[model samples]
Target: MTRLLIKNGAFITMDEEQLQFQGWMAIEGSRIAGLGAGAAPEQEISQASEIMDGKGMLFMPGLVNTHGHAAMSLLRGMADDLALQEWLQNHMWPAEAKFTGDDVYWGSSLAAAEMIKSGTTTFVDMYDHMHRVAEVTEQSGLRASLTRGVIGLCSEEEQKTKLAEAIQFARDWHGAAEGRINVMISPHAPYTCPPDYILKFVEAAHDLDLPMHTHMSETLAEVEQNVRDYGYRPVEHLDRLGMFSRPTLLAHAVHLKDEEIALLAERKVAVSHNPVSNLKLASGVARVPELLQAGVTVSLGTDSAASNNNLDLFQEITMAALLHKGVSGDPTVIPAAEALRMGTVYGARSIGHGGVTGQLKAGLKADFIAISLNKPHFVPYTDYISHLAYTARGSDVAHVWVDGRQLLRHGQLLTLDEERILAEAERCYQRLRG
Candidate 1:
């Protein structure tokens, strides 16, 4: 029966018709109870147990990062300026081999702190030692979709063991953490996972009734390698392998053709577009404009801090908005509103949440962020959507709420100890370096 009210503010519902109103929102428990323009219902305000003054703030749905490796925050800036294969093998993979569960816990703690303070309430994470990741997700109060990313480039016995672990993790953690955490089956990528091993993961996902997440067509080299090894591109190869038969989210898809895009749209597969990470890795830009035109669900992802150096969806949204225009040389491509949707509601849909949490409407989860519009950059707010896409940075976020709980307020964390997390992550990094 706990009721929270937010009033006297500028609210962007991001709902159908893309409404903007100067109004308030009421939260009854974890779901939004009411939202409107002008004045709120007197009875709703009177029943509120907690009231937050939203004056001078633009309240909108909390940002959703559809794909990331959360624990890789510990390796941020450690392996930069390298292509995919060299970076993964020479730098990331070797360092990751020495990691223990405690390392993952601390790293994930640090990552959660960064994300919460920056206004990302929900994110999809794929990495190893995911039990520790789940523990942190529960304690941090941030909603997350987590998976044990398996690379099946090992002995047959080793591959079997990894599959068992992935299944066990899916069994124990699906819809866990009071439903704040969701579990997904992840076969790291087409190149890393052989066809048979990936089929086993697909089978597990089907049995568990959960969706799948994986990297696909991230780079030209990877696509060429897929063709060389499998005699077909990843999209067709995976479709042939029955991956598209299940609900799947594919990360990257930077190298795609029109027919491939059409196939993905037909199969109802979603894509996670990591603009900054792809540019940094020289992975090339995704055919986002074409994909969206084909009615394919294209959402935003930051990949990992190690590559992009930050888990800021604002940056990704901005990149998606501007990069497409510059590359396509068309001003009308990926408008600000559409870019914002990709980072928020579209991202929620990609991770299987959709309208349940990514909008400011009644009955949706009370997962939204409040950004202070009092800054100089935000002055003359001719268009809030444009400001959010082109001018806003993560630091402008003043508050974040997920599932009716405040995780960050006044740019500080409420559910986690930031200093301790920073110290522990630093210690872990020191150990890794030593």
Candidate 2:
């Protein structure tokens, strides 16, 4: 097996102790062999087939984006500054209806390039044409949890067709790409799906034994609509429909109530907090401090480039750290370290990767990134986590690796052609506009 060693780097291992040290890491094939503070033993160095000098870099686990629609990168800025429903109904859905599988492929490729450049190794995507998305994921060499999100507001036959497509997608793609890809079952949302249709998705999830993902309680308007339609809030409605019966990850969740928070914790459902997207759409801030205190796993996500205008997970991390404190009037809430964890460790756990690639540890997948920390923004690095959460930008990322394979080197993508992706994305957008 090929062996590689990265030495003389400042390592931020987001393990249980949050160990930060100047050390070396050994990679044997696809897994981390060992890592520790200080110089490597001569045996490890001598046996290495390749050695990388990490002297000027800060190495940390790659960011995990818990929720996003990768193909929406094509729709970025296409229709912004609108409410979620308006954006979806008046603009997004119409354009998406005209999307071919090729559009999805190129758009998803564009998203993968942005994610790799920004140091995100794993992401969860829910969208249509997911086979194209999975193809992009396989080619880009990134880990992903993908779902074919079904909107069930149409006729009964159309709803059945969409659900069948979703199920076929899950069966065909789950555990694909050398175990780098996993599949999920998703109904678009409570407002879009009837209770009976949502129950069908839950049953499919149980049959396929896959996790579930969906949008829920993103805005007061959405919650109120759910209450008006179903006589219950979004959370309670979904819970009654048995979505929580599976391991579930909810996107947005900006308008959750106290009881909803407690119920999420009790059911062990995870929430992907999209601070930038919510703020952009004028959605109220999530009760994050309360959610964290309630023992619910809160992870960070960018939602979609159309909503967030970017795929940078660092922006989400910084926003998550600052947004809650500002709203709660508590400076201590969502400290820098916890915010960073939300983007990395908690994100992995939320997507059912808790024991996999969230941290830099022995026996785990070697999914990590090296940031050039010599810039002015990172100077006087009194606290690494603080600097990471407050000052670091995605452009600081210099190198990225997943499964011990280098995907980005010196901020350039190795597995993907960025120029072609950009051109195709533009072409697709123009086509959609017509």
Candidate 3:
């Protein structure tokens, strides 16, 4: 196993105390072996096969995106400023229906490129033709949790086939890609999937020992529709259907009530807060402060490039930090360290990968990014964590590593061919346009 060392960098260990110190980190193969402030011992430094100068950079756990549709990168900016139902029905779904496996491949490749460049080392993707997404993830060198999102608006036969695909995808891909890729069972959303249909996904999750992911309570209309159709609110309806029983990661969750928040807390369900997409779609803001206070693990997600126009989790973390403060009229809401955690620590827990890749601690997988701190914006680095949550953009990412392999070094991607990804993505876009 190759040994790597990062020296002379400021490290943010998002542990319980949210500690920050200028330090060095030692890595053996895929796991972190040692890290500390100041110079590492001569023995530790001598043991490294490769040594990197982390000077003038800040090292932190890479941003974790808990919800997204990687193949929707091609649909970005095609439809904007529309409500959820109208947007999905009139614009997004119609465009998606024309997507082929090749389209999924190129689109996912493009998204993976963007995500790596933007310092997102981990992400969750849900969409059709997910095998292509998995293919892109394998080449991109990013850790991911993936699922085939099933919308049950089709006929029984189609639904049966979709369920089979979801099951097969889960079975074939879970723990694949050197344990960097994970699979989940997704049934789209409450409004699109019937109770029986959603139950099938839950059953498949149980059978496969995988987690469940889905859109839930994204809009007030969705919640009301669930109440009208199922005689209960979305939270209760889904709980009754046994979705909360398994390890579940819910997307959006923007329209949850106070009691619903408590129930989610009690059930230990994780919420992927897609603030940018929710705001763009005019969906109400999630009660993030309430959720956090109620002990719910709330993480960050960009939804999809189609809705968010980008997959920058730094933006999502900033939005989560600022939006809650603005909405609640409490400046103390979602402090910087907590907001950073929303995209890292809480995110790993949300995806059921806690203690594996979230924090900069020994024995954890080496999933982290280095941001250039030599810029003028970082002149007064009174607080590096605050700067990360408030001032830094994804473009500031200098290097990224996942599972001890460097994917982006000095702002250049090592694993993926960027030129080819962009060209094929354009080709797919032109085909879709025609």
| Superior candidate under lDDT, 1 versus 2 | 2
Question: For model 3, what is the alpha-carbon lDDT of residue 20?
Answer: 94
Candidate 3 structure quality by residue, lDDT tens digits, 1-434 = 89999999899989876489998999999999999889977988889998888899899998899999989999989989999899999999889999999999999999999999999999999999999899889888899999999999989999999999999988888898999999999999988998899989899989998889989999999888888888999899989999999988999899877889999999999999999999999998999999999999999999889999898889998999899999999999999999999999999999988989899999999999999998998879899989999989999999999999999988999999999889999999999978
| Candidate 2: segments with Cα more than 4 A from true spot | none
Each candidate's TM vs. the true structure? 0.99, 0.99, 0.99
Error of 3 at 5 (Å): 1.1
Judged by whole-model lDDT over C-alpha atoms, candidate 2 comes out at: 0.93
| lDDT per residue as tens, model 2, 183-287 | 999999998999999999999999999999999999999999998988999999999999999999999898887889999999999999999999999988998
lDDT of 1 at 4: 89
Candidate 1 versus the native: TM-score?
A: 0.99
lDDT of 1 by residue, 1-434 (tens): 88988889999888976478898899888889988888768887889898888889999999999999988899999989999999999999999999999999999999999999888999999999999999999999999999999999999999998889888988888888889999999999999999988899989989999899999999899999999999999999999988998999999999998899999999999999999999999999999999999998989999999999999889999999999999999999999999999988898998889878888898999999999999999989799989999999999999999998889889989999998999999999999877
